[model samples]
Target: MSNKKKERKLAKKLLHKYRLVILNEDTFEERFAIKLTRLNVFVLTSISAILLIILTTLLIAFTPLREYIPGYASTSLKRKANELNTKTDSLQKAMLMNERYLASIKSVLTGEVKTEDFNRDSILKAARQDIDFSQVLPNRQDSLLREKVDKEDKYNLFEDNNTANFVLFPPVNGAISEAYNLEEKHYAVDIVVPVDTPVKATADGTVIFAEWTMETGYVMIIEHSQELISVYKHNASLTKTQGDLVKAGEVIAMAGNSGQFSTGPHLHFELWSKGYPVNPTNFIDFE
Candidate 1:
């Protein structure tokens, strides 16, 4: 019974009303008045606080004003960062490709490439499959001319030219002082010429090496198309340098007895095809 009485007392206090008034101080006249219960005031205050918290959360989550907060990245900054990442990737790929290209060039220059004998007959046979052989008949003169051409081309190495628009130019007009002898390990032909004779490029190519060596003296190496490389040694001086572009018959060096192995003024010319040394007389007439 005592507990019930205490509970009733507490409820009465919670529901008790209070009068609030606004007054004219001098006249003591009531201008405004309101009656509010304790429970009503508490409920209204709690509701207002919750509403204010929800509004603050919404502003921060949905508006750009959230950028003012710490540890938040701006939208523009994120976009720029992504763009820079893409550019970096592209630059890396380009750099890798350039490196590979340079490696291939270096291998060719250093004679480190593997040798492969290209089968011209097989390639020509495959290419001839598309040709129409019954286009026309040849006259008696044409047959004679064809026979003459066939005889002339029988021993010519480059007669069935594989590379398009490719032709070799003789480096110099001189007699062969020392012919290429594979049995004696002599891989180059010694062309006997007067000192300071101009050595011309054999084909359109880029100069990859132009320098002096103890055994070969001043040497110039040119890289031509169709896996052909020409080397000129025992030079008095070089007219072209590395990385230079030269056309066929362009003067590249001067012939002289400049090396330790040279016996007289001459040009030591070497031809390499697909990393293997080839006889220059096969493709060029040095009579």
Candidate 2:
């Protein structure tokens, strides 16, 4: 054979040793082969597996997929969640108590109960009467019983109607910022107005309290008939003093920002009836 043919044969033999076939030697057929070592295949497969695992771990840890994993949240977040649940439970309990009280009142009005024993004091009194402490201690002293009676009397006095009616000194003019909410410690409605705006009473009442407070600032309270009371706070100045009888629509004070808690010049007004605060918005017309 010629030198060229011999060299071609040697090259074809080397290619075959490396798992590569010489194609189209006599026919138009193509051949294919691979020369991968066992170590190379194993390394490639291991790297692919590691990459897949890392990607999966990242997806589960940093994405929303982590929600499927149980107990993944931090302890502080869980504690806050528990606290919110407890508050919700307490609110639900209070709502149920209010509902029951309203139902009891309705039943009494419909002649369900022998008498209207729905008031808080009356209910407590009835409960005390039904209790038999003598059974627990037959030799209970009479002095202790007398002391209990005195305590009950004092409680009754404390529960007496301390409510008063209130009058609007300034009829209308301003915007209300905050509102009265006993739960939030904001026990009055905050009315925002220009400095030195006129403050009026909603009804005729006698001023029971007129002073300055750290929270309320330049406060005034008036007591009226039917145990209704009105409070005006955060005033620039007081036009009246304690025991001063003021009529409705009378200017009792000027609106001002005198206290540290006040954000601007405004009056914080509150209304109480029978020692219980009621929503002032229900009675006053805002203008």
Candidate 3:
């Protein structure tokens, strides 16, 4: 037979009708009946399978249940994991540095090392190291990259190119107990939040400083751009460190009465433009 004829024959066989009937078991009478075909059944099953697959895919891709799947993690989850790992590594380094400092203190207390009349020549010789004075020539690719970076950095907050339109996140949710007073040398505003309240970043930036000082206590400062900097002072503890990038509204510290100047728990938030302090209340509304 010809190919066309063969296909027609097979199609006819598939289209063959079948009877699906429910017979009364006691009386042998047909209680119900429906007409069905092989082709019809096959098509129905295929469509049902396709619908099931579509629903399953949508559920996994669009819902939080996707996290339950092995080897699958959302973009935000991955980023958080990386941030935590970086924090862990930084803490390890800090611990090692602290250990070295403690060891030096112990040595001084025990007289294991001489405090004075040390050998200046030995110190100078130990400090001496070989220097690589080879000049590095800039390639075409490097020059192009440098130019691109410089061009992008030119329109920063310092130049007032775009920051005036940017909205800032409130560092804390509280009442402003103290306003910015430049005449009184009070450059920052004091927000009165309950103790242990989180202090958040006002913009996306890298932490430039996170340390304890006698005046500020546990202070954290973030550098947003060439001209913009946000400082959170009198914190109980800092969650970020120098060089760590933080997003707007991300918690960077906890509010507390840490410094000698602080009488109660609060967040002393300061915004700096260029070398001068700006009124944070102008951009952020604590109330």
Candidate 4:
């Protein structure tokens, strides 16, 4: 027979219906009867297999049961494991440093090391023993040049405007809650004001730092011309970001008590000149 005739005969055989009957042999009565075909059985089997595969895939992808599968790990679990390892490494380093510090302290306590047993003159003489004393003194021209350089540097930072005499704008209009005290090491002035009161900048400058700290809360540092800087701390919120240029008397923050050291709503203001913390009270009046 031809190929087409063979295929047609195969299809007819597969589609040919057969009656399925169930009956009790002794009763001689049929309980059920149904018509079925080879093609129908094949299609039903294929559909069942597809549904089973879909169900298995869903269970493996979404449920924790997937962890039971071999060679499978969640991404989140790996990230957490990495974080734990990093913390452990940091803790190990800290412990090693502490152990070294303890050893040094023990050495000092046992008289194996002396922290303050040497004289200044003897130390200086021992350090200078390798050098000739004649070269220590410069010629007349060199001394003159050295003096000229020192003179120029003496008035470098405060040449145009002495920070000591520079007029500062008040950061906030409020009563002084805490006065500046050198003994207490409180270099900043604390001014009390109503909550949400605007805090102004003391001078025109670019913001060097602006962020929240555990101790100072919302703190901001501004760098002005001539080595002058202003700090505003314990603010409710900051209006400007780091590297922003701010003008004098501009509202930069709001008075608040948002830090660990704060007792009530206030603005903690500080001024610094040439890396030295200056009392804000010296420049601005809070009363």
Candidate topping TM-score:
1
Sorted by TM-score, highest first, which candidate order results? 1, 4, 3, 2
For model 3, how does the per-residue alpha-carbon lDDT over 1-287 read when each residue is reduced to its tens digit?
69999999898889888999999999999999999999899999999999999999999999999999999868999899999999999999999998986575333222243325789987877655343325556789999999997887654344555665566889898888889986676778899989899889998999877888786689887878655878788999988997899999999998899978887999888877764667887667798
Q: Candidate 4 regions off by >4 Å?
A: 1-166
User: Against the true structure, candidate 2 has what lDDT?
Assistant: 0.71
Off by over 4 Å in 2: 1-172
Tens-place lDDT per residue, model 4, 100-163, is 8557433322224223466999888987897887878899999999999897665333556445
Residue range with the least summed lDDT across 10 consecutive positions in model 1? 106-115
Question: lDDT of model 4 at residue 137?
Answer: 84
RMSD of each: 11.4, 17.2, 20.2, 12.3
Worst 10 residues of 2 by lDDT: 107-116
88-150: candidate 2 lDDT, tens digit per residue: 999999999989855743332222333233689888888779997677554458778878878
After TM-score superposition, what is the CA distance of residue 183 in candidate 1 from its true location, in Å?
A: 1.7
- On TM-score, the stronger of 1 and 3 is 1
- Residue pairs with colliding backbones in model 1 are none
**Runs in model 3 with CA error above 4 Å?**
1-159
Q: After superposition, how far is residue 57 of candidate 2 from its true place, in Å?
A: 99
Worst 10 residues of 3 by lDDT: 106-115
Query: How much is 252 displaced in model 4, in angstroms?
Result: 0.6
At residue 271, what lDDT does model 2 achieve?
A: 68
